[model samples]
Structures are given as C-alpha cells and as structure tokens.
Target chain A: MVGVRVDGTTRLMGIIGDPISQARTPQAINPIFAGKGADIVCVPLHVPADDLATVWAGLKAMPNLIGFGVTLPHKQIVPQLCDSLDPLAARIGAVNVVRREPDGRFRGYQFDGQGFVRGLIAQGVVLQGRDALMIGAGGAAVAIAFALQQAGIARLVVANRTFDKAEALARAVNEATGTSFATAGAPTPESGQLVVNATSLGLNDSDPLPLDVSMLQAGMTVAEVIAKPEITALLRAAEQRGAAIHSGIHMITGQVSLIADHMIAALG
Target chain B: MVGVRVDGTTRLMGIIGDPISQARTPQAINPIFAGKGADIVCVPLHVPADDLATVWAGLKAMPNLIGFGVTLPHKQIVPQLCDSLDPLAARIGAVNVVRREPDGRFRGYQFDGQGFVRGLIAQGVVLQGRDALMIGAGGAAVAIAFALQQAGIARLVVANRTFDKAEALARAVNEATGTSFATAGAPTPESGQLVVNATSLGLNDSDPLPLDVSMLQAGMTVAEVIAKPEITALLRAAEQRGAAIHSGIHMITGQVSLIADHMIAALG
Candidate 1:
C-alpha cells in the first residue's frame, strides 16, 4: 500500500482499552493491511472503563468503522454489549475481537486463547493430555483456560489472588466443557507440567511475579500473556532455573495475520 | 513528522460529510501537520447526515480526537449541536471547523468568509467599497456575505433559488453587521463588480451554472467556493468574457494554515 493516504474511502479499525498508549496492535496489524494493499488503517482508542457504553454506542453508529480489537479491561465486559457472539467467545465468556456487520450489528469473536495455543503448538509444545497450571481468573485467563481444555489437557489448576474468582472460573470452564479436571488451587512445585502466567503482574517493573519462582521445576515450561517487556521477571526466573520459556510476543505474532484477514475479508 | 506512524499516542482529526470522498482537507492539512512535526493525522469520515449526532458523540468521547472539519449539509446543522460557538461562528450561523477541548466540550469556529476575502485580497482583487453579487443563501453564502460586508463592501446582492432563503440570509447578515448593504436580488448584467458562485452547482459536469453566464462582463471578478475543479464552468465562462477569474482552491489555501494552527495550538 505504498503511497496510500487516509482518504474518505479508507475504512477504519481501532483497538479500545484504558491506558492505550502502550498498545502494539497498530504497529503489528497496520503493516499487514499495507501488505495486502488494502485501503484500511488501524488506530488506537483510549477509552475509559466508565465510558465504554457511551463509546460503544458511538462506534456502532459509524458506518465506515469495520470493527475494533478488544483488550485488557474491555475484553470480558464487551461480550455483554455485543449483538451476538461465536460459540467459542460465548463459552470462554470473553471477546478479544469484534466485527461490525453492514446492518450495524457488532459480532464478537475470541482469538487470544487460540492465538496463544497456536503459538505454543507452533513451537512444538504438545498440549494433548498434558497437565497445566494457569494464574489469574481475569479475561485472558478465562479465554486461555477454555482453550487449553479444548486442546486436550488432562488436568488443569486455576490460581488467582482471589480464591473465589479462581474457583468460579474453574467451575464455569468445567460446566461449559463437561469436564472434571479443572479446580481452584495454589501454585506449588508439583502443580502441573505446563505453568502459565495469564496475569498483568509482569507489565510493570514494580509488580511482583504472578507465582513463586521457587515452584518452577527444571522440566516445566512457562508462558506469559504480557508482551511489552518480551521478558518478564517470571520468564527470566523460570529460565534461570532451567525451565523452558515462551515470550508473550509470540501470541500476538501468531494471530496478527488471522485478525487482519478477518477484518478485511468482508470488505472485499 | 518524518517516518510518522499511526501509533497509540498519535491524535486524530477528521473531515465529516456525506460525500466525503471528494474532500481534500486530509491531503491539504496533513502535510501541514507533518511540516510542524506534529503527531496528528487527518482522515476523512464518510458520515451520513442522519449519523452526525452519533458520530459527534463518539468523537467527543474520544480523548485523542483533536477536532474535525465540517462540510456541506453538516455545516449549518452542527452549529446548534456545538457545546459553544465563537462570535464569528454564531454571527454567521454556521461552523466549518471545530475543536474539542480538554473537558470534552466542542468549540465551533467559522473561517469560510475570512478565507475567501483573504484569498481575493492576496490576489490583489480589492473589495473595499465595491459592490458584490453572491449566488446561493446556504452556509457558504451566509459566511461569505458577512465576510464581504466585513471587508467593507458597499453592497451585496444575495441570489438563491428560494427568494425567501436569500432574504433571510441577507436580513441576518445586515442585522449582524449593523448595515443595510446586503439585500435579496437576482443576477443581472449589471449586478455588481464582484460576481461569486457560493453554491454546489459547479461540482458536477452536467450541472448548470449558478448564475446566468451571459451576465458576466469584462473587468468583473468571478470567484468560487467549490475547490475540486480548479476551473469551474462559471470561472471558464468568466475567463472567456475577459473577466478576472479566481480559482476555488485559493479559498482553502488561504485558510489551511489558520485551521491547522488553531487545531494544534491547544495541544501544545
């Protein structure tokens, strides 16, 4: 899309989140739009949590706004605001991507969990019949937990600062999937074969690790959901203790093409 | 703004109109943004007349949207929708530009008339004490009429398809300027020394001239507000009749810097 200009015919896509200044969606996805030579651009929308309803109404009225990416605090909340949702998004109880139909109806979709799973699988980490331990019961945690189960994980343990939240999330996933493997528990050395940090604890330097580093074993594999630093304290500590480590950037990289394709497919 | 990217921190400005495909504001003012190295980009938003209110609400809620340019049918309607209006905008009863304040309030401003006057003056077409004949009584006509009066024009005859509309616009301008120089009239051979087309008639190829071209004579200066075609039918006819013809692009060129400066000043 060399020489492409932001003219009237250009369609718009935006990523909505609070504290949006640190987002990499535009940098990661806009180039893909250019690569396809499509007259579409992605922008960042800094929307506060309280004003989400107002902003959502406004976005629905924009005929040229194809859709937007959901992140952080918006992912779980936007599900109720959407007109409809795919089964995966509905089951996960979270949406990371949305598409606006021609009739102005917003349809929600979940790609975060699938992207993370694909990223790990692409690196040759098998999830089939493997036991996994995940931190946090938030939006990302819910989506990833469901995806890990769908990927044929044998046993899963959910950990969170609030034990009730972890318990509720585990119960929902089990009920939705008709499985009895998931349960709320604390992080321990023998928790599972796969240790995942689906929390924001690694986003800032002052933040503590999502789980105790001493619990990581030499044969374990650790993964993260925070991408900015590329190397979180947990990942660093896991590496120092000889556990296999995966950076958070791979999750975004794995789904960048899928998101771009889904957004522009209808335009054609 | 060399190598500028549409990242999270980049602020946005847009031109909103129904037929926004023809708008040149993005092409004209985006370079000005780059020249100043401001991380602000202008995009064209194809918002229909019915969706203006919804889009306005959306833009106000967006913390990073600096403002937008108003055009065509939106100019007149947006005045009432603004949170506040400048004296000039209130006087003209229209707004061609808007700035969103830090507190999410939209401030409307008018520059069409001043820009036209400045463009003519820059070209040495003196309007002081001269009589002018303007076509149409819409948003642009009203703005230019008041600007012509403010430029010390001795008389201004406003001609529109609806005589009542012309009369109303003339009455408003005259009362606002505290002068009885502007009045509703028809275009004749000896209407005024300055003949201007302030309507959308010259936009398409098959459209008739706003005024009778046979009335154009030698020594008369014909100007336009339609900038897409540098040489409109009126200007071409005026040129053939040995009259000085002014291109519509000058109107936008005259005020481009003023608009860009006003939009970005508050940001600094």
Candidate 2:
C-alpha cells in the first residue's frame, strides 16, 4: 500500500519518448526518489517526434520542472535543442538525459554508454587495453562504442547488417578519439575480450542472437543494451559458455543511480 | 518513507495554476487515487499565464494525460479550451476541474459551488425557500450565488466593498435564474437563515471580518470558504453567538470525493 506521496511542492520530472508505454525509467527512478526522500516523481510522457520541439519548449517553461529523461526517436534530436551538451554526448550525437542548470539552461548528456560501462565494471570486466566488438551501428551501438573508446579500450570493431552504417560509426569514433582503434568488421566473437549486443534483435523471444555466441570463450565478457527480457538469448548462451554475462537490467540499474545523482545536483 | 510508485503506465493528473506551491489538491486527491487502486499520480504544475496556450497545447497532445485541475487566473480561462462545459460551469463562467473524454475531448466543470452547498447540507442547513446572505462579489461568491439560486433559495443578497461589482453579479445571477431573487446589499447578518463569507478577507489573520457577526442569531448558519486555518474570525464570532458554523475544510473535504469520481469517469 506504499504509494507515491506527490503534492504541490513535489518537483517534476518526466521521461519523453514516442510510444512511451514501454518505458521502465519511472518504475526504476521513482523508487530511488522515495529512498532518497527526494520530493520528485518521474512520469512517462508520450511526445511524438513532430511535437518534440514544441513539447520540450513548453516543458522548459515550467518553473517547477526539474529535468527529463529522453528516449527513442527523440534522443538524437534532443542534443540539438540543448543549450550545451556534455563532450561525450556531443561526440555520440545523442542525449539520453537532460538537466536544467541552476541558471535555467538545459545541458544534455548520454548515459547509455556510461550505464553499459558501469555494468561491465561491476562484473569485473576491464575495458582498458582490451579488444571489444560491438554489434549494430544504431543509436545504442554508437554510444557504447564511444564509451568504450573513452574508457581506453585498445581496439574496437563495429559490425552491422548494413556495412555502410558500421563503417560510418567507426569513422566517427576514430575521429573523435584521435586513434586508429575502431574498424568496421563482420559479426564475430572469436577475438574480442568484450562483446556487446547493442541491437533490437534480442528483444523478441524468436529474435536470433545478435552475434555468434557459439564462439564465446571463458574469461570473455558479454553485454546487452536491451532491457526487456533481462536475460536475453545472447546472455544465456554466453552464460552457458562460462563467459561473464551482463544483462540489460544492469545497464538500467547502473544508469538509474547515475542519472538520479546528476538530476539532483543539477537541481541545486 | 512511502514514495509515489510511478511507472511508465501510471496515468497523469496535474493542478495548473500560477504560484502553485500552496495547492493542496495533489495531497488530497493522490491518496484517494491510491485508495481506489488506480495507478495515477497528481502533480503540481506552475504554468505561468503567458505560457498557458502553448503549454496547454502540449498537454492536450499527451495521450496518457487523464485530466487537470484549474485554479486562479486559469479557472476562468480553461473553459474556453475545453470542448464542452457542464451547464453549471457554463453559467458560473469558471471551471475548477477538467476531464479528458474517451473521444479525446476535454470537459470542464466547477465543483466549488456544489462543494459549498454540499457542505451546507452536511451541516443541516437547507437552502430551498431560505433567505441567504453571501459576502463578496468575487469568483467564489459568484459561484456560490449561482449554486444557491439553483438549490431553490428564495432570495440571495450579495455584499462587497465594491458595490458596482456586487450589483453586476446580482444581475447575472438573476438573469441566469430567470428570477429577481438576487440583489445587491450591504454586509449584514441581520436577515438571512444562511450567511457565507466567500471573500479572501479571512485568509489573513489581521483582516477585518467579512460581515457583522454581532447580528448573527441562533437560527443562522455561518460558513467560510477559505481552506487554510479552517476557522476564521467570522465563524468564531458566529459560533460564540450560538450560530451553526461551517469551516472551510468542509468545502474541500466535500469536493475531493466528487472531483475524484469525475476524473475517474472521464478516464473511461
């Protein structure tokens, strides 16, 4: 029977995305807000892509609106609306979190990469001087690649169903990191110390594993960025192969705490 | 340590007003939502007057937004944005509640007057064929005057510091009721079975009483519409003179259930 105790003075926060009914941020962060005794509740707001700018403008005008979480279609667009972006988010070309500064300016940051990296680190997986292979060149893939590069990974390979997208993401990462570490490659689990599934393939029960998990080896780390069905087929296969497995829930759980901290500090 | 349990699917309700820090609607209604086993949370939104149109447009586009409560500066303006208004709200020219119909249309309603009348009835004060004196010609007073007329009150005398405003309101009420039962008068407790203070005078501790409570008789019923502090000097003085006293909380308590019911039905 414990419920959210929101009143006139409770500060406002929301997660904005198209088809927002599937978002888990509210359930993840609201409980944290309660635990911290923060008078804030984050709700899901269904802001279609066409209405993103208009809705964002209106939300910014609200004096009690503390901040918001950005997801899906809007993530790449939100960075353009921010007054400033964290260097990492700028490099990734997307934003997953927006904080309203005390001076009333909005600053955007991407937490997907940080969340993934945190989850890996929590499982005792080291990225520094390691070779990592990322599957997909979509939004999540790009963020994780940049985060891995930033974490000092010695080499990074991006594989995609569309080779052009993988090459483009590799170029972006290489240019941003000032290194020749990132390259486009076909899906493989044979040579990397870290393997990541950053695609939507693992979301459905019938969806194929994003990569060749049959080649997974002991001591190698496997990670997923998809949240639904926390233990994806990829993770299960990696687990059975004696590979250290990181489920999508770890990324969400890790990001929730970081995002909450960033939002609270921004409110100050 | 109980906190609001909000997930992506939780329905949203908000109180829209300027200077929203003092509103009690969220505290009153959110608990009721929990009691009803509804996954809903009401929050306070400080929407300034200048951004009302833009923000309202954004709000209307939110597919999960159930409804909103309107307050000062917005109450009179919200009905214009709604697709329809309840007849009582249309006549009162103000709306305190709005519900989003299943057809995606918003309907406006005013519960203040009904709440006051309900409170009066709860205190065993009958309005039918009874003479009533209402102090103030402001928003609350106008609504109460119309509600009293609708309840079959034989006569209503509206008194205010500005006689012109009182006279204008009396004209509107009389025209709406198609009867000359309401008139402008000076503040007095001398000749009515029911006397109500619908003005802001009772909000401050040092302000003078809205009416002459010295003339209150044992058979008279006295009521105040200010919710804070519950009891006002006028009600205290009336109580001392053995008059039936109705505190402001009764109006709020009486309306909470009614408003909750309206919002829930609107969600369907």
- Model 1, A1-268: lDDT tens digits are 1223576677889899988887778878888888898778788888888888888887787777889998867987999999999898988778888998756789999998888888788888778888999999987888888889888889889999999999999999899888897999997646348888999999999998888898786778898888879999999999998899988888888777778889888675
Model 2, residue B212: C-alpha shift (Å): 2.3
**Judged by lDDT against the true structure, how good is candidate 1?**
0.85
- Stretches off by above 4 angstroms in model 1 are A1-4, A121-138, A150-175, A178-194, A204-221, A240-244, B1-4, B19-23, B46-48, B121-133, B151-172, B179-194, B207-220
Best candidate, DockQ: 2
Clashes of each: 0, 2
> What TM-scores does chain A show, candidate by candidate in order?
0.84, 0.90
Candidate 1 per-residue lDDT, tens place, B87-179, comes to: 999987789999987667899999998888888888889799888888888878888898888888899898889999999999998788788
- RMSD (Cα, Å) for all candidates, in order, is 4.2, 2.7
Off by over 4 Å in 2: A190-192, B1-3, B79-84, B122-129, B152-154, B190-192
lDDT of model 1, residue B117: 87
